[model samples]
Target: MAESTDPNPAAPVPGLPERILLGAAYYTEYQPYERLEADLDLMAAGGFGVIRVGESVWSTWEPRDGVFDLDWLQPVLDGAHARGIAVVVGTPTYAVPPWLRKTYPETTAHSATGVEIPYGMRQDVDYSHPTFRYLAERVVRKIVGRYADHPAVIGWQVDNEPGHKIFYNPQVFAGFVEHLKDTYGTVDELNRRWGLTYWSHRIADWSELWTPDGNSTPSYDLAWRRYQATLGHDLIRWQTDLVRSLVPADQFVTTCIALGQQGQDITVIGEPLDVAGANLYYATQDGLELPGAQGLEGGLASFFVPWSGPAYLSLQADTARGTRQAPFLVTETNATSIGGTADNFPAYDGQWRQTAWHMVARGARLLNYWHWHTLHYGAETYWGGILGHSLEPGRTYAELSRVANELTAATDALAGLEPVSDVGVLVGAESRWAMECMGPLAGPAHSWMGDPGSYDRILAAFYRGLFDAGLAADIVSPGQLADVGPGLPDDAAAAALVARWRVLVVPGLYIADDATLDLLRRYAEAGGHLVLTPRTGYADADAVVRSTVAPGVLRGAAGVHYLEYTNLVHPVPVTGAGWTGAGTAWADGLLVDDAEVLAGYDHPHLGQFAAVTTRVAGAGRVTTVGTVPDRELAGHLARYLARTSLPVDPWRDARPETVTVTAAVNAAGERLRFVHNWSWEPATYRLPAAVRDVLDDVALAAGELLALGPWDVRVLRETP
Candidate 1:
C-alpha cells in the first residue's frame, strides 16, 4: 500500500531472481504429440527461465465430479525443474469442467434475469453462486495441494485472466440488494443518494429495486458495475488466500489481469496479489511503426490502436505497473500473431526484441508469451505461437530466443528496474463505468449512437501525447493519490507526492468524489501542474451531475467555467499561439474567468469560446483542456507542460519520429536507458552521455553516434 510516486523506490520482491524472467505458457496437455523432452530441451536452449502451465484445462484436471487427475502434469514439472526452467502452477478455476456444468445447471451465469449464458465458452458460470464456489474451491485446493511442494513450482497463477462476465443470477442480484442495504443502512438513504425520486424510480422497499438488465438509470448502473467488480475482487482475494494457505511463502500467488476487462477494477483486484501481473497484446507489423498510423477515427474497435503505436503499448505497460506502482510480471503477450484467422499479423523480424526490451524498460520483471506452440484444433487455432502450425521453430522463435539471451546477459543491470516518470496520468474505474453508462461521445460512423469507448479514447489521447513528446508517464488511479503509505509523516508525505510527480494529467474523470477532486486541487496548489481534460469532475461519485458549474470543486483552481458543451459531428480546427490541430468528437464551450486562453476554435460559430486555458493557483498551475485534442495538439500541450514542470530529459535530443528512449533506475541506483528504432528504416542517435551497452558489454563515449538497424533496440547504462 505504498504511495505510487514515493521518492524512495520499493525494493525488489524477495523470492524472485535478480533478472528478467522470460518464457512462455507451456500447455503440454494440448500438444498433439508427446514431445515433452524435446520442448524442455528447446526451452533450455532458448534461455527460457520459466514456464506457466495448468491454467486452462479444467475438464482435463477434473474429468468427472469428485474425480481428480493431478498426476498428468508431473512429467512437465519434473522436466522443467531438471532443465533449470522455473514453473508457475495455475489453478484451473476460470474454465469449468463439463461435469460440474452439467450437474449444476443453475450455477450457469445469467446475462439477464432468467436468461442463462450457454456453456460453450469459458467463464460462463456465476462464480458467486455457492454451488460453483464450492466446486471451484475444491478444484483449486486439489490442484495447488498437488503441486505446491514441487521443486520446480516457483509461483502460482490463481486464475487465468478473470472478469470476463457480469453475473445476473438470482443469487447475485439478491446479494447486491444485501450489499446495498448494508452500504446505505436504509432504503431511504439509497433513494436520496441515488436521486431515485427523479422519474418515479424511488422504492419504499428493497424488494422493489429493479434488476440491472434494463436499468436505464445511471446511478443504478454504476452501483451494479461497482458491486459486480467486488464479486471479482472477492473471488480473486479468496483464491489467493486459499492458495497462500497451501503454498510456501516463497511461491508467489498472482492472477494475470486482462486489463480493461468488463465488470472488474484492476486496482482493486490486484490489492490481494503478491505481485501485479497483466496480459499485454498489441497490434504488430505496421501497427508497431512510429510516426506512422493516423489517430483513431472515433470507432470503438479503433480505440485499441492510437496515433502512436509505442504510446498504446506503453500505456498498457504503464497500466500494469500502476496496479502496484512497482515492477510487474508480463503473464502473457503475443508470441506470434494474436486473435482470429483473419488477424495473422505477427511481429516483423526484430519487432519482437524491440517489444521485449520496451516492456523491460517500462518496469517489467518477467515476460511470458501466451503459449509455447499453436494448437492444431481449437477456438484459437490461428492464434500463432513461437512455433507455427507445423510445430517447427521459425522467425518468432529465433527472434525471441535472441531476446531471452540478451535478457540473460543484461540481467544484472536490468533486474528490479524502477521506471522513472515525471508525469502521472489518473485513471479510475468508476469514471470509466459511469461513462459507459452515459455514453457521452458518439461513434465515428454514427453520431446518433453512443460510443462505449469514450473514456478509453480520452485517456489514451493524453497518454499518447506524453509518449509522442518523449515523456515517460505513470498511469495512476485516484485511490493512489492520497495513500501516503505506511510510516510517513503527513508533511513529508505531501512533499514526497508532489516532488515525485511534477505534473498530473486527469482526463475524462467524469465520476469523482469530493475528496479526490479536493486532492487534485491541493496537488496544483502544492507546486504541481494539474492538467484537467474534458468531462473531468463534471459529476459526483454517484454519477449524478453536480448542481454547481462544470468541474465543480476544482473550478476555482482551474479558473475556467463551462455551462454548455457540444458533440461535434466532424473535427473542428483549433489554433493556439504556435500550433494548429483539430479537436474531435466533443467540445466544451469554455467561458474563461481569469485564466489565460491558450487555444481557440477556428469555426465561425464556435470562435467566441476558448478551446484551452490555464491559470496559476497557489504555488502550482492548473491547465484545462476543453476538448479531445488530436495527436499533434496533445503532443504540443505535453511538451509545454514538460518544459515548464519537468527537468530537462537527457534523451531529448533523439529524433522522436523514428527513435524513442525511456529510462529506469535499477535496484543499484544505476540508470538504464532503452532506445528503440520503431521503424522499417534504420536509424542512429547520439549518446547524450557516456554509456555501456549492458547486453553487448561495449562502451561508448558521450556524443558518440550509435547506429541501429531496422526494428532494433539497445539497452544502455549511464557511465561516468
Candidate 2:
C-alpha cells in the first residue's frame, strides 16, 4: 500500500484555515509577477492567505485533448507557495476542453427530449452517458494523480459545481430508470409503489421504462423523480467516491454548487469532505441579497445555511471593492461577471481585510475569493475574478498575502474548533426528488390539474416560502447524524438536542424511512413537536418499494388511511392563465379523521379541504399542512409551531430588521452569534443574557443591546 495512515479522530482536522484564509485565483495568459505581485502584495496586505489555483488550467493544459504539458503549472504553483498561500486545487470536470469534446464526442450530453447541443456550452454533458462519466473520471483522476502530493494542494473541489443539469438532461431519466430496476430487481414492483395504475403508466418490462422528462417524462409521478433523484444523488456519490479514490482520506474534498440552483441535493455534495463549504455572496444593500442580481433568495443561506452534516465552508464574497457595488455603491458583484455572466459588468479594486475579519467574526473558517485568475479565453470572457481582465494584480494582492498569513497563524485553533448549533432541520434528498418528479401540483394521484404545471409551481412556492420566512432551515443527511450526543459538531449534539428541539417541520419530503421518521416520531412522542407538511414520510430511504402515501416508510406513523388525496381547495381563487394560481400563497387542502383543523382552504371550484390538521399520537402531535404554502403562510406555520413546541424562543430577543442575527452554540457550549447590521445607520442591539463579544471579551448587559456601526460585525460571548 502507498502509506498506511490514520487521520486523528480526536484531534480536529485542518480543513479550512483559521481566520477565513483569503486569496485570489491567479490565471492570466501572460501577466508579469510585478503586476501580479503588486496585486499579491495588496492581497497579502489585505489579509488573504489561501489562493485558488488552476480552475482555468484546461485552456493551457491541453489546447487539444491527448496533449499534456506540465510546463505552465509549475511556475504558478511555485509562485503561490512562494507567497505563502495554500492552494485549493479545483477539478476541471466542468468546461470540457474543445479538444476533449472533439476527441470524445460521445461525452456530450443530450436533453431528456433528446435535444443534443454539440460543443460551446458548460454543463451540456448528459450525466447518464457512460462516456461522459468515463471522460470526466479520466480527466479528474489524471489531475488528482498529478497534484495529489503537491505541497500547495490543501483542498480539492471535484467540480466548479456538478448537477447544474438535471432539469434538461436526458441522462437524468435514463439513469433513474436503470437505478429503479437495479434497486427493485424488477419493473412491475416499481409500478405498484408509484400507483402507476392511475395514468396507465404501469410497465411490465424494465426495457420499456422511461425517465421523468418530456418524451421520456414518466407520468410526473413521485416515484419517477424519487428514482431520478436517487440517480442524481448517485452521480454525486459515485463522483465523490472517485475523488476519495484519488486523494488520501485526510485531504478535504468537495464540490462547489450555486445557491438554490444546485440540481442535486447539496446534502450529498458535502458527504466526502471533512468540511462542507459553499460560495456565500449576500447582497449588502438588501438583506441576504447578492452584489449582482441572480434569483429571489439571493444569499440568505449562503454561510453554512443550516445543514445536518460536516463543517461547511463560507468561501466566496467581496466585502469592499474598488468599485461601489450595491448598498456599498454600484451593486457591483465582482470585478467582472466571469464566474459566468456577460462581461461589461462592474469591477472593483480594494483591500480584502475587512471582509476577512468580518467572516471570522461571522464564523467562516475557510475563505476563498470568487475567481483567482481571469479565465484566459472562454471562462473569463464574462463572470467575476480576483485577477483583473488584463490578467494581472491590481489592488487585492498584498491584502491576500496578509490575510492568508493571519489564517496560517490561527490555523490550528480554527481547524480544531468545531462550529456550534442547537436547531436541527431534517433534509431528505429523496423527498425533494419525489416532489420534483411529482410535478407542480402534486397530490396522491388524485387532484385537479395533476400535471407538471401544478406540481412544479406548488413545490417551488413551498420551498421559497420557507426561505422567505427566515426559518434558518437546512437539508440534513441521516448518515451524518447516525453517531448521535453533545459537545460534538456531528451527530452527537443532534441526538442530545432531542429534548431541546423535539419539534421539526418537514415540508413536502416523502421518502423518510422508519428509522429516520422514528427519530422524529420518537422525539415528538417524547413531548417533541412535529410538523409533517403534505407528502411526508411516505417512502423508504431507497424510495423504491414505498407502500405508504409518503415518500418512504414513515407513512404509517400519522395513523391515517391511504385514502385517495382528491381534495384540491385553493385558499385563494385563481383566474389568470399564468403558472401561479390561488394567490401563489396557500394552495393545498388538508385531511383529518380525529385530528383538528388548524387551517383550511375554500375556493369556488374545489370544495373545502382541510389546510391544517393536528392530532395527538404517542407523546407528540403531528400537524399536517397538506398544501404548498407561500411566504405569507409561513407566519401561520410559525404561529402553530410556536403554540405546539413552546420551546425557548431562539429569536426571543431579536429585533425586527435594523440588525439581523443568527445564534448557535459551539461544541464547547460557547455561543457564537452572527450579528449583521442591516441598515446604513448605526444602531444598537439588545444582547442575550450574559453574552459577550468573543474577541473583545467585553461583558454584555443582560437587557441592554450594544451600539454598532453600519455593516459592523460583533461576536458576542459570556463575560470572561
Candidate 3:
C-alpha cells in the first residue's frame, strides 16, 4: 500500500491531507490518446498532488462478461505513483456496460408510470434488481481485489453520487410493500395513519396499494419518499462495506454527494462513508441570478448572485460536515463551465480562484475538478476543462496553475483550520418532500408567477438573511439531532449541539417527529436561543396534521397558538421591535398567551394578533415569525436576535450584495478571515483589527482603509 505525504505516516488513517489538495479528474481511456508524460508534466507544473480515475468507465474495464482488462490502468497508476501523485479509484457501477444491459433488459429502471427508462444515460438500471446485483458484485469484487494492493491507490469512491434516480419496477414495488409491512406491521395501522377513510382509499390487501406518484395525500407521499430514501441508503452502505472489506485500513472509502439536490436523503446515504465528498458547480457568469433565472431552486443554485455562491456552498459544506462530524472533499467541481448546454458560460480570470478558496473556507479538505481534459466526443463535450478539446494548455489551466502555486506556498498558513459558526439553520428532506406534495403555494407547479413564495424559497431567504447579517452559520439537518436510542439521551446531545451556536433557526419545518420536537424543547429549556419561521411543526413524521393546534408540539415552546392562516396576494404592513416593514405570502393569526409581542400586523383586524412573538420557555428563549419576512426585515431580525438574545457580535459594514466576510480559526489559535468584494465596482473596506495578509505577508494597522478592485478577496491572518 502507498504511504501518506505526512512525515509521521503512522499517525492514523487520515481522511484527507492536513494541507489542502489540488487536482483534477484524469482519464487515460477516453479519446485522442493524451501523451501521458506531457500531461503529467503539465499537472506537475500546476503543483497537483492527486488525480481521480476509473469512475466513468465500467465498459472499458470489462468489454465482455468475464473478460477483465486491467492492464491499461496499471501504467496510469504507476506513472502517477512515480511522479508522487496519489490516485483515488472508483467502482464503475454507475454506468452499466452495453452487454450487461442487452442481456438483462429487466434491469432498467422503471418510472412511476410503469414506463421503463432506456439505457442511454448513466444510472438507468434498477439498482435493486437481482440481475444487476449479481453482475455488479462480480465487477466490483474483481476491480477492488485486483487494485487493493496497488501502491498508488489512496482512496476509493463507492459510486458516482448514488441518489440521482428513482426506480419503480416490480421488485421495487414489492420491496416497498414489504417495507410498509415491516414499518406498520399491519394494513389496518397503515390505513389509519394515512387517513384512508377521507376518500375511501383504504388499503384492503397489500397488493392493492399503489405507488404514491399521482396521489395528493401527504402521508402516502411522505411514506413513498421515506421508502425511496431507504433504498438509496442501503445501496450505498452495501457498496461502501464491500470496498472497505477489500481495501486496506489506510485507504479511505467515500462517495460524492453531488450538487446538493435532495432526491436522496443526504444524511442517510452519508452515514456509512468514511469522509463526506461532494461535487459543486457555481455560475461563472457575472450578475446571473440562476435559481430564478435558470429554474433551479431549494439551495441548488450556486453563484446565483455574488453572495449566493458562498451561501449555497456553505450550506452544502455544512450539510456534509454535519453528516460525518468531519471535514469533506470536493470530489467533483467545474474546471470551467458545466451541464449539457449548447453554450455554457466560462469562468473568468480570478472567478475559479474565488470559488475554490470559498469552498475551502467553508471546510473542504480536497478540491478536484470534474475532468482533466475536455472531452472530444460525448454528451458533455461542451463542458470544458483546464485543457481545451485540442489537448493544449488554455486560460483555465493558466489560472489553475497560479492558484496551485499559491496554495503550495501558503499551505502552512491554512494547516488544521476549521470553520467556526455561531448560528445553525435546521433543514431536512422530510420537510422538502412534504412541501413538494403540497406543491408550491403559488398555485400551479410550473408557474414561476409566485416563485417569490414557495417553501424552499422562504427557507433560502432565511439562510440569505444570516449571510446578509454577516453571521457565520451551519446548515444543520434534523438527522444530526436525531436520537441514537438505547438510552443515549438525544435531548442532552441536542442541547449541547445547539448550545454551541448562539441561534438555531428552523425554517419551514413542516414535518417534525416527537423526538425532534422534544429536542428543540430541551434546547430552549437549557438556555439556547431559537427562531422558528412559518410552517414549522405543523405535521408529524407521518405527514398528518396535529389536532392539538397549529404549530403543534412546538406551541408550548413558542408560547403561542394559531388556528387560522391566510395567503396574502400583496404585502401587508408590519410594525414592532424597532423596525417597520411589509410581510408577504402567508400570515398566521396567532393567539398570544405568555409570549411577548415582538411584531404585529399593521392591519385593523389582523393587527390584534401578533405577527412575531418572543417567549422565554425556561432559561432560554424562542421567537416565532407569523409571516414571511422580506430580505431587509429578515436581516433586521437576525441582527436583533444576535445582539439581544445571543452573545455574538456580528461583523459590521458587510453588505449583502457588495461585501461579504467569513472567518475561521486554526489549531494554533490564529484567526483567518476572508473578506470579499462581490461587486463589479471598486470599493473601500476598513480593517476590523490589525492583521497580516497571509498571501503576501503584508502588515496593516487597525481601521486602515483598503481599496479593493472588483471581485477581490483578502486572506487576513489576525495578529495580536
Candidate 4:
C-alpha cells in the first residue's frame, strides 16, 4: 500500500514546539495548599513539557456571575513560563459554577422531557441555552483575554469533554423540530421518508412530533441523536470561534472529546477546531496484556467504551487520528488509575511507557495525563494522578518520567509521524446511532434489552483481530470515503482508494447511503479487498431497513444473500480451510450463490449456511463474514487477509507471540517502528534491517537480535 501525508495540515501555531509534548492537567486551584511553585519544579524535573490548566474549574474562574477572578491563574502561567514548560489554557465551560446554576435553573438540561437532571455533577446544563451560552462566553473571554499573550500558552482547550448527555430541554426539542424541518423540508416528506404511517403516527403538522422520552421510532431516534451530535459540534465551533477572536494567532484551539460519549460524533465535532484532541483512558495492568487477554469481555462492563487489551488502545488512537486524518493530542489519559474508588489498577512497571509509545506510534502528538495531583476530596477523588493523596511522587510518576525522557530523546524522529496502515475499517457515527436504537446483539446475561455498544462490539471483534495478527489499520469514516467521489465506474477515484488502502474492512456499517454501498462495490472491483462483517449495508442513512436482500446494494458484488440472521445465545463452532474457532453474539445464515465458501458452521442445522464466503469481482475480491467472530477466528481472518492483500514485509516474519510491531513514517521521510512486548516474560526479535534505536541512540546491524524486557517497547528507525 502507498503512504501519504496527512490530509489535514498542522495548525499554524508558530510559538508551539515542533515535538511531542508530555505533561499532565494541572489544577492549582484544587490543591489543598500553596503548591504552584512546587508543582512546576516537579514537572520540570520530570521532563514534562506541557501542562493543560483552567478547564475544570469554572466556579473558581468566576466566583459569581459578572464577577471575574481571572488573575488567580496568573501565577500558574508565570511559574510554568519561568520553568520553560508550555501551557494549554482551557476555557472553564463544561463545568458550570454553583452561582450560575442556582441563578439560571432554566438552563438545566433534562435527561427526559419534564425531568430535569439534578445539579451538582458537571455538564448538567443545557449548553445550547441562551442563558448558558451567554454566561459561558463571559467567563471564556475573561480567561482567554487575560492569558492570550502569555509566552507559556501554546494552545487553548475550549472545554473539557463536551458531550456528556443528550439534552432533552424544551428549547432543545424546539431546535430539533427546526432541524427536522430543515432536513426534510415538510411534515409530509418526513412522514413518507420515516414511514410514519405505521401505528397511525403520521402527523399533519411538525408540532405533533412527540418528545424523545418514550419514542420507539428508529427514524426519530436516529435524527434526534444526529441533532444532538450537531449540538456538540456547534458548541465546540462556537467556543473555538470565540477563543480564536481573543487569543493570538499562535495559539491553537480545541476541545477534549471523549470518543465514546453518547451525544457527539468526534469526526464532525473536530472539524471546526485546528486539531483533534481526545481523552484516552484505558484499563491498565492485565488489560494491556496481549495474547492472554481475551477480547471485549475484559473491560466492557465497567466502562462505556469497549476495551480489549492493547487493541482497545489502538482502536482509540486510530479513532482520534481518523477525526482529522492527522496527528491528535491526548488531553487526558491515565496517570495512575483511571476510575472511581474500587477501580484502582495502576500500570505495572513498564506498561505506562508501552502505552505512551503505542499512542505515539499511531500519530499522537501530545500525551497529557488527566491530572497532576490526585484530589483529596471531590467526585473524582480516587481518580489517581501523578502525585497521590500524600502529595508525593511515587511509581506512577517515576514511570511517566521515564516515558517523558524517552519521548524527549526521540522527539526529532517522532515529529509529524503518520502511521502506516495496511487496512481501512469504516466507522460510521450514523450507523452507530442506528445500531444503538435497534441493537443487533443481546445485552449482558442474555437480557431482553439490546446492548448499546452493539456497534462497538462488532467493530472491535475485527479490530482486535487485526491487532492480534500484528497489522496496522486505520479507522476510516464514511465522510472520508464519500469525499473521494463516486467509485467503480469512475475508475480513477476507485483506483485511488484501492491504492490508498489495500484492504477495507467494514464491520457494522448498518446505516449507509446508496452511494457509499456502491462505492464499496466499486472499490472491490478496482482491486481492493473489501471485508464485510455482520450488520453492514442492512439499513439506509435514515435507519430504515432496505426492502432488497440483506447487505443491500452490495449483494451482487458480495455474491451472497442473508435473508435470515439470529442472535447467537452461545458460541457456535466454526471450521474453515485450516483454522478452528467459534462465532459468538450474532450469526447470519448466509446462502451463497456464486461465492467460494471460506468457512462453514460446525453445527448440524446451521451447517447448511456458510459462515464466511468470498468472491472475485473484477480484479479485486470481496469477503463476507456472516457472524461476529471470536478472537481466534478474527485473528485467523486478519492474517489471511493481510497475506493476500498486503505486500510481504520483513517485520511479519518470525514474529513473537507476545510482541506487536507497528510502523510509521515521519515528515523527514524516515521509517520508524515501534516494537512492544506485552507479556511479563522477556522477548527478543531479530532486526529486519540495519536500524538505529531512537530512544537509546544506538545502532544495530541486520539480523542482530534485539532483546526487550517484560512489558517493554523499543523505538527503532530504519537506516539505509
Candidate 5:
C-alpha cells in the first residue's frame, strides 16, 4: 500500500487545490462485481481528480459490534491512488451498524412526540448519547489509525451533515436544563425573562421547566432551538478534534452543511472545520412556474422573474463561501434529478454546466457530484448519477466529461478569484429561531401576518432586486461581524471584512441582542449605509419583546418609531419621489422623528403615516422600509443607492429582463466578469470593451450586441 510521506504536521491550514477539483462520491462496496480497476479507468477518462468514499457503509466497515472489516475499502483507495485520484474519507458515523444500534438502543434519537425513531434510515441516532460517543470514538480511532498514513487520502468529511434531526432524549433535555441554569443561575431569572407570570405559569423549581412541546412559551422554544444548534456544533467540533489528534495538519476535515435545516446553526457548525462545504440542490422548474408566479398586471409579483432559481442558488452559494470567509467546496450536488420520481425533471442540456460554473464564479474551488453511478437498489435508486444503473457510458457521463474538460482549461483563470460587491445582507440564526416561535403565518386571528413563506419571500425579493439592479451582494452572518475582543483574530482582517461593504440590508430581524445592534450602529456611524425593513429589533436575543418602542436599541440610528402595525388583507397603494408601488404582508404605522419621509401610504386612514423614511447618522445613513416593497420600488431603491454611496459601479444599466452582471478580481488583481441572463426568454447585452470568454475563448468588442439564449451565462476576462 502507498503511504503518506511528509505532508508536514504543522502547516498553515492548506486551502482548496490551486486548480479546480473535479470529483464525485464513489462506492466500491456497492459495486455488483469486482470493478475497482475498471471504475478508475472511467474516473480518469472523465478527468476526476478525487473520489469521496467510506462515508456511507458503517455496516460494511464493522460487520459485527467491534469487529472491524476494512479489507474491502483498501483496494478501492489503492486503485484510485494508482490512477492518480485523491480520496476524501467519510467518518461513516451518520449510519449506525445494526449491532451497535441493538447493543445501545439509547443511541437513537426520539422525535418531539417522545417516540424512539426506528433504525432503518440514517441520521436517526442521538449524537448526544454517551453510548454513541463511546462507540464512535472506538471506530474513529481504528479507521484513522489505519488510514492516517494512506497516500491517497486528503481529507475527512465528519458525519454527513449533522443537525438533520433534533434529539428529544432525556440526556438532551437534562443538558438543556443545565444550559438554562448556567445562563440564568436562578429560577426567578428564568421566570422573569420568559414572562412566566402570565397565565400563572410561574415556576418555583427548575424541575418544572420542560421541553417546548405543543404550545410552550415562545421564549422557551427560542432557547430550545439555540441549545439544539449548539448540540450540532459540538458534535462537529468533537469529531474534528478527534481526527486532528491523529492525522497531519494538511488532512482537512469538513461536513456538508445543508441550508434550511432548522436545527443546526450553520455559522457555528462551520467555524471549527478547516474548510466549509454545502450541498446545494436547485428547485425544480415545475415548482417555480406555477400560477401567480407571473403576478397580475402592474402588481408586485411582476417585478420578479416567474422563477427565481438564479437568486436562490446564488444566495445558497454565497452563504457557503461567507461561512469560512474563503473559497468553499460543493461537497454534494446532483448530475440529474436528485430523487427517483416521474416529476423529477432530468437536467437540461446545458443546465448542469451552468450550475457548476455558477458556483465557480461565486468562489467555489471544488465541485463533486453526489455519486458516480445510480444505485441498483435503494430509496435514491433513481437519483440518476453521471453513469446509469447499467454502468454504461451514456449522455449524462458525456456531459460530465465535457464540463470536466472545460473546468480544466479555465482552472488557471478561475482559481483564487474573489467576488466583489458593496452590499451585505444581514442574517442571524436567533432571528430565524424567534420568527419560528412567533406562531403560524396564516390564520384569521393573525391576519396581519403574511403566509408561512413570508420571511423567505421578503428576503428573496430584495435579493432579486439586487440582481435587477445589476449589483452582486454577500450574505453576511452575525458571526462574521463580531468585534475584536478577547481573541487572537487578525485585527486587520476583521476590519477589512466589514469595511469592503458600503451597504447593509436588514430584513425583518425581529430578534437581536444589544451587542448585535451595537455592531450595526457602529457600522453605520463609521460611514456605512444601513437599510432596514419592518419587524426588525422588536425582540431581544432572548426572544422577549423589547420594553422600548419598536426597533428597540436601533431606533436612534434608524431614526423612526412605530407602535402599531397591520398585516395587509390586500395590497395598499404607496407612492413617493416619483416612484409608485404597493405594500404587501405587513405595514408599519410610522412617525418619523429625525428622519425624512421618502415614501408614504396613499390609503385613506394610513395617509398620515410614512411607508419609507431615511435618517442621516454621522458619516452614514439608514433607510427604514415599513413594508415589503413592490418590484418597481425595489429596483428604484437599488439604483438610487448604487449611485449615491458606491465608488465602483459594476453594471451599466438596470434593465431587469436583459442581464445581470457580477465582477470579481483574483489574487493577481485580474478582473473577471460573470454575466447571466436569469430568465427563461432570450436576452442581450452590450459589451463594455473587447473581452474574451474564459470557458470558450470567444471574444467580443465594445458596443457589440451579444445575444444570450434562454438561461445562458458567460464568464468573460477583461483584456489589458
Candidate 6:
C-alpha cells in the first residue's frame, strides 16, 4: 500500500478545452539553454503547455548518485512556469547510471530461464527486488521533494513503460505466485479451481506454486485468468506505490503503458498510480507487433474506456518514412504527419482541425505531442521530432499553434459540455488478457483458430453498429461505474448506465468484476429492461465461476441459469427483428425464468440464446446477443438501438460500415455523438439535424443524405 501524499500544484485549470488540450514534450538533453529558449518561444506562440521534463540526463544530473545537478534544467522549467506553462517532470529510471549497474550487478536481473544478462535492454529492472525499490524510492523522494512545490511541476511521470525488452523479469514468478495466493487464499483452493489435478500441476502448498516456466500454459487459461492479470498488475502496482509516497496528491503521478501484449498488464498496472495515462501511436512504424492488441480502433477503445478518470495522451510519437525521414513531436494538433518531409505534407488544414476536436470529444483531458524538437544525435542519426534538424518552425508548428490559439479561446464552452452516449460496450481487461493468452503467438491457451481476429471482430462490429446508428456511448470497463459522477443524479439519469450501459446496447459481457456484477444486479432490480446473451454474468474476472448454480452468486440479477456446455452453433435463417440470414455465432444456453427469448435455436438439438430481452431496472431494457455478433447483424443492432430509444439519427443515412459511432449525455441530458471513420479514403456527409457539427459548422437535417469523405468525423449534438 502507498502512503497518501499531496502532489505539486498544477498550472491553472485553464477550463475544459473546447478542442483538445495541446502540448509538446521538450527534450532538453540534446540542446543547450539557448536552443531550448528559442524553442520555448515557438512553443508559447503555438499555445503549447505541459512539457515533459525528462530525467535522462544522468551524466548531466549527477556526477555521482548523491551529487545532484539542476543547473541546466532550472532556467527552462522556471522560464516555462513564469510563462504559465506546466511541466510534467519525468523520473529517469529508464537509463540507470552505468556506475550503479556495474557497482551492483544484481540490478541486472536473471531471466526466468536462468540467464545472466548485462546492459542490453533499456528501462529494464525487476520491480520485485527490494534493493531496486529502495534506490528508486530514494531517487524519487529527492527529485519530487525538491520540485513538488515548483510552479511548473504539475505531474510526475514515474519511469517510462516497465518493459526493458519483453517485460520478462524474474519478478514475474515471485509476484504471480504471491498474487495467486492473496486472491485464492489457499493453494488447495487454487488447485481445485484451476483444475490443476488433471494436468499434474496440483499444488500441495502455496509455497510450492510458481508461475509456469519458459514453456507452459498461457497465463489466461480460464482457470488462471484472474491470477494472471493480478500477477502482471501486482508488479506494476508495487512500483507505483513506491512513487506515491514522494509525489503530492494534486500533482498526478502516472506511468505510460506501452507495448500492449505481454510486457504490461495496463488495467492492473495502474491500480497503484493516480493517472491512467496511455502512449497512443496511431498508424505509426512503431514496433511491438502483437496481433490482439494492435490497430487504431482497438487501441482507442482499449485505452479511452477503461481508465475511468481524466486521461492524458502521454507520449504520441511523430515520424515519417519519407526522404527527410523526420517525425513530429513536442506538440500535438495541426495537419497530419506532413511538413518539411517530402510526400508527407498536410493534405488540408480542416482535416487536422477535425481530428483535434474529435479526440477532445472522445475524452482526452490533456494531449501531449511526442517531441518538441528533433534531438541532434551528436552525428549519429536524426530521428523523430516535431522540428527538424535545422530547428526551423516547420509548417506543422504554425498550424499547430493556430489550433492551440483556437482551443484556448473555446475552452470555456468545452469545459461546460459533457459527453453523451447511448451505446454500451463492456471492456474487460482480464478478458482481453485471457484472449491474448488464448492466442497462438505467445503466452497461454491452445486454440487452433487460424487467426486471432475473434476479439476484434466482435468489438469492431459493435462499434460500427453504434456509428451507423449515430449513438455515442460511454464504454465501461468492469470496475469503472463509480467514474461517472457519484449518486447518479436525475439530470444525469440518461447518462447513468454504470454496470450495464444505462439501457442501450448493453453488450452481452464476459468475465465481469464484482463491482460490475453488483451494479448490474442493482440496475436490473431497479426496473432496467435488459437483453441478455448466453454468457451474461457467466464468468468472473478470473474466468472462474464456470456454472451458475443455485444459491451461487450473480444468478439472480442476471435472471438466467446458465448450463455448462460447449460447441453450440448459431441458428441459421436467423430472422429476429432485422436479422434474417445465415450468420455464424458462438452460443451459450441457459434456463430462462423472468427473461423472454426473442431469438434462439428453433432446432431440436441446438439450444442457444441468440437474442433475448427483459424489462428491468428503471425503464432500462437489456438485450443479450448469444454469440459474438456477425457483421450482417448490424441491422438487428440498429433496430434494437432504435426500439430502445437510443439516438439513431446521427449517421443513420450513412452505410452501416462507413464509420463508427459512440454517444454520451451530459448533465443536461444533451446527446453528444462521436463519429469516427478509420478508412483510407475520405468521407463526406451531413450530420443528423438533431445534432450540430460544431467542428465544420454543418447541420444534419433528418433524412438528409451526406457523403462523409474517407476518415472524416462529425460530432452530432442532440437532446434526450
Highest lDDT model number? 4
Give the root-mean-square deviation of each candidate in angstroms. Answer: 2.3, 8.9, 4.8, 1.7, 5.8, 8.8
Checking candidate 3 for backbone clashes, the offending pairs are none
What is the total number of backbone clashes in candidate 6? 66
- Residue lDDT tens for model 2, 1-720: 011011112233345433445555555444544355565555555555666655545656556565666455665566667776677777666777777666766656765556666677787666556776776677677777887777777777766655666544555555566667677776666666555676577788877665445332333354454444454556666777887787766676655555344365555554444444455543222332211122223232223232200012121211111001100111112323323342233212211343444445434456666665555456345554656567555554444555456556544334333322223345555555554444445344654334433323444444433333233332334543343432464333433435434556665555666666666665555554566665565455544435444422333445433344543443453221221223332334333556666554445533455555677866666666665554456545654554455544444336444454544434354545556543446777776666756545566777786787654556565543
Best by TM-score: 4
- Per-prediction TM-score: 0.97, 0.73, 0.91, 0.97, 0.90, 0.72
lDDT of 5 by residue, 1-720 (tens): 111111112122353466777888999778777788888999898888888899888888888998998767788888888988888888888888888779888787888747799878888889888788988888888888889888888888888878888778888999999999999999999999989998788889999875656645778888899999988888899999999898976788888788757779776788888988788766444322212132212111112222344566677788787676666778888666665444345565556666777788776777888888878887777776777888997766777777778888887887667777658888777777766556323433554333434556667667766655666777767666652222534444333433656788887777788877777776777676788887777788778888898777778987889989887767787878765767766788888888988889889988888888888876788888888776667766777667666654424463446466777776576778777665567777878767888888888887677777755678888887
Rank the candidate models, highest lDDT first: 4, 1, 3, 5, 6, 2
Which digits, one per residue and each the tens of the lDDT, describe model 1 over residues 400-445? 9999998888878975578878688999999999888777888755
Give me candidate 5's TM-score against the actual structure. Answer: 0.90
For candidate 2, the 10 contiguous residues with the lowest summed lDDT are 321-330
- Give the local distance difference test score of model 5: 0.74
Model 4 lDDT-worst window of ten? 3-12
Q: How accurate is candidate 3 locally (lDDT)?
A: 0.75
Model 6, 221-261: lDDT tens digits are 54344444453455456656665666666666666555343
What tens digits encode model 3's per-residue C-alpha lDDT throughout 1-720?
110011111222344666687889999787587588888888887888788999889898899988898777888888888887888998898898889888889888887657888778898888878788788888899889988889888899988878677777888878888988999998899999989888888989998897756676779878887887787787789899988988888899888777434458776677788887887766565522212221223232233222344556556666666665566788988787676544466766666777777777777778888778988888888777878888888888887777777777768888766776767788878888778677335644445334323666667667766766777676667876553222446656655655465578999888898878888877887777878888888888899988878777678888998988887777788888586666777888898978999889888878988888989878788999888876667777877777766554334543435676777776685888887766567678778788898889999888787666666777888899
TM-score of 6: 0.72
Question: What is the number of residue pairs that collide in model 4?
Answer: 0
**How much is the lDDT of residue 253 in candidate 6?**
65
**Which 10-residue span in candidate 6 carries the lowest summed lDDT?**
318-327
Better of 2 and 5 by TM-score: 5
